[model samples]
Target chain A: MKTIKDIAALAKVSIGTVDRVIHNRSGVSKKTKERIEKIIQEHGFQINKTARILALNKKYNIAVLMPTVESSSDFWYLPKKGIEKASEEFEMHRISVNYFHFDPLNLNSFKDVFDKLLENSFNAVLLAPIFLNEAKERLIYLDQRKIPYVFINAELEGANNISYIGQHSFDSGALAAKLMSLLINTEDDILIVKVRRDNVHHSTIEDRISGFKSYFNTRKTPIQIHEVILPKIKDQETINTLLHKKLTNHQIKGLFIPSSKVSVVANYVEEHKLKHLKLIGYDLNEENVHLIKNETIDFLIDQDAFFQGYEGTKTLFNFIINNVVPPKNRYLPIKLLTKENVKYL
Target chain B: MKTIKDIAALAKVSIGTVDRVIHNRSGVSKKTKERIEKIIQEHGFQINKTARILALNKKYNIAVLMPTVESSSDFWYLPKKGIEKASEEFEMHRISVNYFHFDPLNLNSFKDVFDKLLENSFNAVLLAPIFLNEAKERLIYLDQRKIPYVFINAELEGANNISYIGQHSFDSGALAAKLMSLLINTEDDILIVKVRRDNVHHSTIEDRISGFKSYFNTRKTPIQIHEVILPKIKDQETINTLLHKKLTNHQIKGLFIPSSKVSVVANYVEEHKLKHLKLIGYDLNEENVHLIKNETIDFLIDQDAFFQGYEGTKTLFNFIINNVVPPKNRYLPIKLLTKENVKYL
Candidate 1:
């Protein structure tokens, strides 16, 4: 309940002198600053946060660059909702966010939108870095300019990011393997599917598969494993033809699709009536949710994309607003959702 | 950046008159209030929250009632840490908490603590309702006084609470069942262990066990489950003797301990070197964490008991400060932790 005036009077200093000391302005003598601070600390005078924020002379602009929402996956909804919730919480602090959406599939679109963002004077950045190599290069430029950035969902390797708020991606892959081991039959081969266009953002996929393979080796399980990377641009029949041949040759007990686009395989299994195959995938998109509800996908690891964006923005905001840096690598707990619990979500 | 002075000037009213209208005080005339509100809205004005909170001359006290921390299980740390964190966050809001810890195994200790909490003039309560029947009786008196209370960790049957923030314990048990179905062999029997005394919190135990049993029945898994309840006061020798007999008599492949005292089983398993039995239990307690690290326990379901207390307290604080009522049952996510990822915590 003690004000700055009370502390100034107690310390036998002028109110303006006390204010200078409290705000760490250079004008105050070191002796006067120490005297004023002693009284302030003793009195436990908490600076009114609202007044402090209101007194801030300038507004903060945070640039959020992420993939645009499309029919491909509902993963975009998670971070969008997280950012929306944070905006409402941080509105009073003169913090505002400008959203810049980009096409996940097209590198040119990512560049165009990202270039537009750097032109504006933003205090910080929150991005997915789906276009990994370009983002890594840009991150160094951002570092030179002293603009803090955070990674959401996908943590690019060896970036100077303030923090990476997402799943421990490699462990999530091992968890998929753990779930797969439980759901499959003995002597049934496990399939690791990578549904992507090319080597763009390939490290993330590789880390996951490597982790999955290592788990089986650690357990010394004698299950045969098959690796398949289908072309992201393939036509339906071509995809079906390749999948049909794989399924025909191997006793595919359980399938592990280590990406958000699990719908592509969900379509293949359901269409072909591959009742023998148990499936494990990621994300909670509409198509995946539909498939899980129909009992097509056995288990969906919820990456909690919502909390990634929400916590990521909070970390950046805390640093900008309070000089409080959050943990550099904030790992989210991996959650497993089955048919029974998926309905409640 | 429009201030009250600017809005008051634009509205052609005194600053005090504008203040009355902004605070929704009774002194302002309806026509004058409407005229002032119109100008305030048009100017995009926000009420200074620091000034508003400063105007509140009273302090709020929230009574937190839960089980006392014992060396047997470090489960109490979760909610205590959560509540402590929330207290730090709400420290500026003039809100404080007083903890009342009770013994889980002793009903008399629970009653002694419950009676002591009622004497304080706390505006709100956050509780676990561990001693169910006695709590139900005491809640009527609390309701008559019109004090809002939120439940944490355990939601007793038919209690009128402001909100409940914890896991759907039943579904968590079912999830345990699903995991067990995957880990156990074709002929391996499952063991459900309840480490407690005298049914002090029996309903919670029964609900979890029933849910676990029903999952196997629904899935038509030909896995027979055996239930055992051990005395809380039994000597180490007695516990070892009983456990030795149980394990020796049955082909127990997987053990499910729904409570935080998975240490009882973990101790027996490690000491006996029961390599064949896989274990699943709850919390991130030191004992559980140690066990999980050594691969003594296979899986630990993280109920995030910290968030239960923290979110539950925030809900009560929001209702008291802002008249905002949160959801009645706020379910925390069921997190599955294995040996590979337990190191991160």
Candidate 2:
């Protein structure tokens, strides 16, 4: 372990200049900083993390922008809990997290919350870039300011993100297909149910559908895949009627709902006494978990939203403080949750 | 945020005495220790962990006893790597780990290793109690000496283990059965293969078998199941011959191997051109991972052996240093890995 004094002597610089360069303070000249960094790298000099952070004694403020947790569906709450956990653990390191929430359904609310978030000064940002276009435009400010940002649940295409911590949507979809293939026989047809208010689908859902079809493409015998894009996500009666109409015409043996709104389909399946249909969906929302426990849902693909949020925040902090560069895309394991294994997850 | 001074003042004791009690050093009187402990607990005083560990400046030695890694099968190497990772992370805390390996096949080698491990002074122990009776006897010596220990892969029924961090064998079996059920239709028959040298099966193997059976018991129409216990684990020809003899008599659609020797059966299955058979097995050993990649195995139930070893070491260190009492049994999640999701896992 080489000391700072040793590096300073080798670089022919004062210890204070070396310290400033190490901590990324602006006092040292560019050439001196580069020379000191090269020497440190050459010797593989490692600093004591806790002691170094204490010596610097700089407070970091992280801005977290995400969708508000709706009372009806507590999906967002899981990530919030994970972020809070990270916040609590990092408090001793002088890291504080300030959260700004927006309505996921309302684009105006997203803009308003993002504007409010930009008004405040933060060392870095952790966000779920839901509205892609709006998020892309607003992220330009972060790039201009040279503030590092991490994406949690969703990501902007070709954006300058430090890391994207979430599921590989397409891979998860393929996994769901594999599970569904096992659940139903080769002769059985499957239905891809999408319940949302708008016709324009998110890239994640579209990618999942594509991934699902890609899996079936590898099969020897082609199985029929039907898609039902319902306009009403929250209106259970309308969803039930739409699903009922689709089921009557086609003999769908397995149902693949590629969204957190899986509990709705599970409810419909349970109410209709569709014992032959094996349902696979996403997320471990309260209702989804309950349905899984009751065996209404055969499988729930857990994206590990909690880990995405937790790791996203930690990634930003580590990058800003320790200069640890995370992978461009950090995919959480595509966890398959059933009645037998859901509790452990 | 209560400090040591506040705790000492509350207990009417010197800061040194409070420190002794906090570090569990033999200096404070019994009554004074109890008084200081009560005050600290009542006030919810949390000492700064890193600073406290630095103040103690005590080097902890942990003895790890497990099976030696055989060159032919690097199954044990995964856990060893995990332990080494933990060892590297905790080096700053002055925690050192000493490894002692035993031949898992031979009882005398286990005894010899145990004797050698007992010769050294260690603060704590982490072990995989493979030979139940022999391990039980040696663990008593550690109990008498009052050294805390944690179990990694397996557990003794009535041992005083501080914590057991591993897969719940029975639950993993149940999870495997669940996955197998999804893979095969109701008409398909399954085979449970046990590839081991001994006739008397370990409790973990038996538990997995029970869990596998228990899962089928819940189904409306029970599927026929056959068993094949081979004499040699390493003899590929004998395993293939025995499996061929068994498969000729029955229409086994799905195969479930309770142990990590699933790779052997996978090899046999592939050689025999058992394309209709859906195989499920345990662990991510090198061969098994390759087979999974090539699509010879349908599903692999990952026990997360690496996490088990890593967490066991961490549990012992935390219990000894931070006084954190881990749960009696910490079950790692039952992971279902397939060709699609294996890469992410």
Candidate 3:
């Protein structure tokens, strides 16, 4: 039943000193803080939340940086929905959010966006560090300013960010490997494809391919595996011809496309009437779902991209509003999608 | 960039009046509040979050009420784990949680626990409303005190609670029916089991049964559907005897248990060597997992009970801290579990 005033009186300190001690704020002397803490423990003093709400008034603004959604893919759209949900919930508490978008393929665009964002102040930030080097450089200023940031979809090493929310890329790849193994015979060859635009280095694809190779190697599978890298250019006919030649030369029984552009390979496979080959890909884009429904893509791995964005924003808000520290890393569960269960999604 | 001083000067009011208006507290005249709001809008003043944290120093207490884990068929343990995880996250925020337990079938014990909790003061409460009338009675007191309470597992009608975090019983049952149909033939007869203690009313179980029957009725299949209600105290021998009689009399080809005691039916089927019948059940208990792995149970419908508890507590905390209103009813997604996917869980 003891209040803050009673604790302050018992500890021979002002109410302001007691408040500072309770909030762990700088200004109160260590000796007075220790004395007040002892009395608070002895009396089991509790703060009345209703009274605190009536007295405190504050607002915050948060900034979110992520890739812009283009017509090619709508993956970034899910995270934007999550950020909007958080913004709506926190608006009553006077918390506002400003969004900044950068092209996933353009590192200079990310640097320019971050430079503009740093000019304005934010209470907190949530970002997807897609352009690693540029993002790391921008985070140095965020560290100096002590503006906490959370990472979604991709993580940066040795950054003192608040948290990271995304998938365990290696495990998801292993899961894809297992699903692909189910569709092909032991003697058949497997093809791994990586597609990228001209100036973009998709590191996530590399991680997934490594995971797929590690799983097959650990299992000691006898199937011959081939890696194919296609440049993002006007050489579509050349790439298609190469694909046809590879299909004719090596009786490829299975294909693993390590990115969201699985639809491109799926279209080629259908056009060539390669119905005997099994295809496993990533994400649930419109084209991918069509191929999956027709059984052209035997399996698709979804990383629950919606939750990554949702959790990322919510985690930052929790820290800002409640003075709580969120977890350092949050990994979304790897979800396997098949024809039978894709409808529920 | 304008501070409180600027707003007060522009509104021709004291800084204290500006502060009072911002906090929405009484003692500020309406005209003065309007003028201060206008100035604030014009200038876009933001409060210093550091000052708010300094002023607010309160510890919150939450109480959780649920059934104790007594039987090997206890799925309630999963939600309890979720509650513990929430407690760990909120510990530094000075949120303390007290647990009260009751037998799922003992209504009087539930009443006694509620009576004691009514005398104890808490900021919030999280409960599993297993018993309808008793829960309604306690909720009336919670409403009068204006203490926000959330219901988990089952919801009561006209409770005026903050939110309900659980599964939609009918949808869950429909999903179960879909999974069961996948494992059986068109002309096969299906048996539905509803198990309940003598003192408890199995509303959730009945809802599931209704959904299951509705699915078959809509399909207009030639398969015969049968229902059985058994007392909780029935011995394994008695259950086995009754099941043998029913199987011989009706030639049941598939069994769908609409309660947590699906493992009991699995045991009877295993002992009687009724391997020909397709079995589907609820929950991920040890016994059920064994049946699933051995292929006795083709599928198990998991409602993600862990998330129900975790999200329930997190929602309550978010409401308390941010003065946010949660959705009236939040239903967890129905997850389908099979032997092929059980390892991931």
User: By DockQ, who's the top model here?
Assistant: 2
Report per-candidate DockQ: 0.22, 0.58, 0.05
Worst 10 residues of 1 chain A by lDDT: A196-205
- Give the candidate order by descending lDDT: 2, 1, 3
Which candidate would rank higher by lDDT, 1 or 3? Answer: 1
Q: Clashing residue pairs in candidate 1, if any?
A: none
* C-alpha lDDT (0 to 100) for residue A203 of candidate 3: 52
**What would you estimate as the lDDT of candidate 3?**
0.76
lDDT winner among the candidates? 2
Candidate 2 stretches with Cα past 4 Å from truth are A1-62, A71-73, A88-98, A107-123, A137-147, A321-323, B1-62, B71-73, B85-100, B106-124, B133-147, B220-222, B321-323
Error of 2 at A144 (Å): 4.9
- Give candidate 3 regions above 4 Å deviation: A1-59, A71-73, A198-201, A233-239, B1-283, B286-345
For residues B1-345, write the lDDT of model 1, one tens digit per residue.
467889888889899997765543457777887787667556666546785566355689999999887553567777887888888887877887999998876778878898899978788899888778888888887877778889888778677686788878788788788788878886899988888766566555666777888899987877878877777634767778777778875678899998877888889999988878899998887888999988899888887777777788888877676544466678877777787667654
lDDT of 3 by residue, B1-345 (tens): 478888788888888888766644468887887677666656677556676464346788898888887664688888888888987886766788888888665678888888888889998999988778778878888877768889888877677677899877776776666656645677788888766554555456666777777777887878788877555535777676667777884557889997667888888888878788887778888878888888777777777788888989998876675434466788775556555456556
Interface RMSD of each: 2.7, 1.1, 5.2
Query: Ten residues in a row with the worst lDDT in model 1 chain B?
Result: B319-328
Tens-digit lDDT string for candidate 1 (A1-345): 477778777988888887665543457776776677667656756555776666465589999999887543567887888988987898877888999998765677888888888888888899988777778777766777778889888778777676788877788788788778878866789888877654466555666787788889988888989977777534778778778878886678888988877778889999989878899888898889999989899888887788887888888886667544455588876777787567555
Colliding residue pairs in candidate 3: none
RMSD values for the candidates in order, in angstroms, are 10.4, 7.1, 13.9
| TM-score, candidate number 2 | 0.80
